[model samples]
Target: MNTYLHSVSLDREKCTGCTTCLRHCPTEAIRVKDGCAVINPDRCIDCGECIRVCPQKAKHVVCSKFSDMEKFKWRIALPAPTLYGQFEELDDIDYCLQGLLDMGFDEVYEVSQAAEIVSEYTRLLLKTEGIKKPVISSACPVIARLIALRFPYLKDNLLPLLPPMEIAAKKAVERALKEHPELKREDIGVCFISPCPAKASYVKNGFGDYKSNVDLVVSISDIYFQLINSMKREITPVPFSRSGVIGISWATSGGEATAIFNDKYLAADGIENVIKMLDQIENGMIPQLEFIELNACTGGCVGGVMTVENPFIAKARLQTLRRYLPVSQNFLDENERYVPTDCFFGEVPHYKPISRLSNNIGESMRMMADIQRLREELPGTDCGSCGAPTCRAFAEDVVKGQASLDACIIKTARSKCEGCKNNNEG
Candidate 1:
């Protein structure tokens, strides 16, 4: 569990160390070092902002290849609702569903269909007694990781339910096994067609105590061309899409919160805005809301770096596609009001977050004192020449023995000038 795998990597050859990613990163995980920008794994939440902002296209996502799907006898593709928004002038989602089959998948499952079930479960959880107020949606993997790293105080606020992708994967595998009695669990492969690197990281590192049922994560951009060709070749799509308007709406901002029929919910997208809102929430500013839906991507999942279409355009396309759909095609049984116990994820272990200075109160106090002292000595300007995101970060690095005080170029120059003045006076 200590080992963490990230989905995005830097192409050193393509990177110019231009500081574009450094300036835009929400977590301040990147720093220009040795003529290239390096990302610290401990600080990164896999928000894909670096990938989205890179000018040289140096940051690339590593998605599961189609060849990986061939390992199992039955391969199921769980397409994210964002996939439907990539095509222009599209009326039916069945085209995308059937295209996945044509592209070598034995089964096609829409994650949006499972979203309705999750939505119902969320409503039930909110109505229950003693639950945390202003509950946070665990739908976005990046948001979950961001909270775990920076806002550990909000851990209890996170919804314990498994995300739609995980739920769909578990259900898809179960259906495959039930339909084929002789098939073993190992014979089935669940591949999620993801829209971002955060989801890919989620599949790589399972959530909490539960290992993911999803075996592979394929990016939407990776197979967009093939799906387009496949849809063109298939005249009739068989009308097998099970998701409705509520499910499709999950691809855009405020979709989940709106579906819960709760006006006391706050839906915010983009990492910078979310951080500000979370800061306000931590200070007990937003007491009226019962739930907080935060998506790290700009326009929900549609704005992910792995998607081919523009977020606004994709959102508009999704709106057009939802015109003829029902409110919700999937729902819990009429008599069932409780969320299934199996749908809830395991308890997440509380590791020290990135903001945590030290586990020992005395040590943390001493570090803070030292950091404040250095903060006064160094220039307040947040220049990246020191290979640290901020002066405070460099101060911490020095305290931790990862950097030296001499690394502060401005301080060093100031000291040299002071020495020259003293010499002249002598």
Candidate 2:
């Protein structure tokens, strides 16, 4: 589908032509040219790695602003579990919810409710199907896209369930109508307090049979900070029931495993650790762990690049939150399980996403030929020093007319030696 073009963007003003982001990019999507960094949309997985590493703040997530919600008659705030960890003294969930209402929302829903529902649902999946050993969590859209890109073989292993946020969004719409029959479907707008840009994109672009359930996405760092300052003046904490310590903890890695499995599981946060585990699983070295929970962010949702506070601070805040809430029963009532299955999961994708070179056999062959020609002229050093993510990417850069093949140390060395030999012959 060549959907990557919609995945990333670069601000020329913020980029200093430094190769720092290129070196860290996992997909080899970024390249420096004419003192600016440009992203190849087809290559980007929309992982937000560059968003986290950019020094000039040149990189920004394309998401809806708070004012975008003004059109809806009834506004709903769908906060991510990470939202629980954002504030230092969010004694009650109601304060945050009320703050949203004060800002303009009519109602607020906890994304963790859906997280709980899916957690319990997944536990049943583990016991029933016996289909596959390591069922990947579909909560992180970036991780899901990465699997589609780098690990297509594991696609079948993803539990046949929508992400928690989607589940919550559906439940919110249903509950909203039930509580307020006067509210029209069009009248209500749902805005997710997003922890990353990927979620915003997920809602904008349907993924794996999913439609746009969320109407808007407000970055957590943006909304919560404003609420915190708002809280100082009011001094009145809005009281609401808690979703329990485990649900609050779900903001961190392995929180889901704790909510479901008591022990004998692996919770991997951070891309590096998750990649190692995926590699082990692919190589048939998957340990005896019952399940693996992977979050691409460093410290689960709280560590998302879009966050303002450091993840460590968020983790500490989340732990203290546990002191106030009771350990409620993990299972949801049967009525709560009545999800709008139609809205959650639909038709499966027929074609798996393939690499550009592999998309067309004839084109691939020509690209291979061109790559070979560039390789002969390319510097063989493989130093990501040229700001193209890799040596092969540098070759592709040359082929694309964005880079010179002589930029490679090895290629330059060989060119110099050839010149010396010619001089000797003369």
Candidate 3:
């Protein structure tokens, strides 16, 4: 009966109750209980980590289907920049846009074009004074959520700018309204062809006060076969090569950092590496840097689990694709002209602290003390047999009443041996 908007879901029927997802989860959101992986919705960031690791293919991303597009009179496809990397030897970007139209979309808009706009705004924001040191990119929803869950104190470091996808959706809707005045906004559906579940969740439940412009979202892998089949047969191209290399480069790792000119920045990819960098940032280790670009996936969006192609190959393809077109300052300038008058990124609320053990200060302190005492008693080995990632985590779970002290296999075995000795003496 507990309802929460989550992009990543577990298929209980298919789940083997294997601890693969439990061990790999970055947020400790998943727990193996009742012979199935149960996801804690508040803790889940929808990074799709479990989807990639699940051997039984029990983990899946929930997204809008192709059939869902039928409800809208005007269907616009907003393809993520990573979608370009999926096709092999793709000569023109228009070929891909046209292919989306072939997939039954009335129109197509490139998210890379929006990335150019965001990049410009990022540059402008960096120049302004009084902002926090090492401003983090808010492009990755998973990274933003990770900070909210684990590092709430560092929420001010997040760049207060709308991600490229949302900006693109806004622009697409604006154009739709301008071109076709007869149609109602409700009649038009803005669909984002997303590479990850995080984006899909973002569309459904937006960050902060702003509502999402994107009406629906479809996974890249779901439509990969259809797009491939469409691309096999030639169609009229829409001359969609206006977006520059800097914008297109956002699909790969270090691309965002590269786009920002003449600034000391750190570019980190993969969630674990991002977490490490965040820890260093928190400790004031890297004080000289002005910005940090963090991507949840290994090779940025190209490495998203939904994509069919290998991340390295896709990154190489993106690099090659960049060479074909000349770098254009026009796109950068156009970004300034085309953006909405209101600020793209609305006000973001500070993330609520996740470690608040209790409302009363005294009780919370007591809980922490108990957790520490429990941790000292348990073996430090982080063996996953207890269904918790680490001994400390298991101790915390015990204090929270979600787990028992006997759940620790080492403690359970020792207790059993002690009981046997007492029985023999009796």
Candidate 4:
């Protein structure tokens, strides 16, 4: 029961077996079984790709409700930088921070502040000797999980640093404890105002050996009306925003990469484009760069399905907001040269390469051969009619006995059904 805690859910009643989600799913996690889309627990990285492509709106996030924050004594809000761009004509970031306080949060902490810290630490890591070149940003939880599932070889290239959300949660916890010594660790609740459902899934199923410090991940779309209403009440908001251009810039694609202040880096957004870039990296087809930053969403967090505004509009708003701010507001002390010992987690322990057909090399090779042979028999058109995304994927399903060869509508329609071979030959 604890193995899979996916945030994306499919409403079978709404699903018409259109196969839209099956094709859009980056991990091929969706499969139409019995006229309803079913998500495979192992392959799903909770990137919200299916949610974006589902025509019937059958796919939705199973995020934390606003009332869930009442579980603890202190409720702290950790607003991602993407939240700042949701408003139009927003001259100040404090308006949003104060609104969170009015919405029942005991304290408000900017995830962007932590992002600045991450950027600083990342800069230090880049100069460190023996560290892998082309250090892939681990900021996106979806990218990290995708690497573990499909691109395990690139695991070494992953930057060994806690993302802004995690860092913000950790810092907020420390602040809460310092202010109130009577409160226990579990007594404090950290609610992250997120633009992505993948953040919620990350909280549920932690990456590698380190667990997320965030208690709840509530989407911006879920609490949009309430927050806007709260913002309207405050004419003069208190100054609480500690983030600057470098921090807020993390909202869009190439933002984090630019913060590195390094020229040798590649940045791409959208799951499909990200997958393509990762493939190029795996095959060593790209130029030798120092860092690779990828976002599963088109325009990074702003392009998240849960966002209120269009990604381009949000990005433009963020740019305008950053103009009034400094380059950075958070920085390590002059005495500090290296990131503290606590910044990085232990090595990944859970990644076992779930994409492999079998544990044994011989059996895996045999399965691959069978899958290739089945691919030859089936139509090459990737119509997604067989409940699988592509013909190759359908072939894999048939070889694994999870699907029938007769499931291919084209093959069966053309009198090429392998199941009826004996009858046809006789």
Q: Write the per-residue lDDT of candidate 4 for residues 1-426, one digit (tens) a residue.
A: 227588999888999998888888888888898899999988988899888888899999999988899888999999999999999888899999998898899999899999999999999999999998889999898898889889999999999998999999999999999999999989999999999988998898776778889999999998888988889644888787999999999999998999999999989999999999999999999998999999999989999988899999999999999999999999888988689888896765365566799989999999999999989988899888889999999999999999998889999887745557867788
* TM-scores, all models, native as reference: 0.97, 0.89, 0.94, 0.96
RMSD per model, one decimal:
1.4, 2.9, 2.2, 2.2
Which candidate, 3 or 4, has the higher TM-score?
A: 4
The residue-by-residue lDDT of candidate 3 on 161-277, one tens digit each, is: 899898888888999999999989999999998888999988887877778999999988889989988874455576765577987899998888887785598899988898898
CA shift of 232, model 3, Å: 4.6
RMSD score of candidate 2 (Å) = 2.9
Between prediction 2 and prediction 3, which has the larger lDDT?
Answer: 3
Model 4: ten consecutive residues of lowest lDDT: 345-354
lDDT of each: 0.89, 0.75, 0.84, 0.90
In candidate 2, what residue range of length 10 has the lowest lDDT sum?
347-356
Candidate 3 residue 58 Cα shift, in angstroms, is 0.6
Judging by TM-score, tell me the better candidate of 1 and 3. 1
lDDT (Cα, tens digit) per residue for candidate 2, span 1-426 = 554324346889778987788887776778777678888665666778888888887888888788889999888988887876777776676677667777777888888766777777777667765657677777777777777777777777666678778877887899999999999989989999988888877787767666867888888877766677555446675566447766676789988877666475778988778778777877879767666788888888888877878898888887887787776434767776543455345533333443446567787788878988876666566676666777777777776577776566666777789999999999
Model 4 clashing residue pairs (backbone): none
- The residue-by-residue lDDT of candidate 1 on 172-281, one tens digit each, is 99899999998899988999999999999989988888899999998998889988988863387688899999999999999999988988998999999999988988
Model 3 residue runs over 4 Å out of place are 1-4, 232-236, 329-341, 349-351, 419-426
Which of 1 and 4 is the better model by TM-score?
Answer: 1
What number of backbone clashes does candidate 3 have, counting pairs of residues 3 or more apart or in separate chains? Answer: 0
Error of 4 at 245 (Å): 0.1
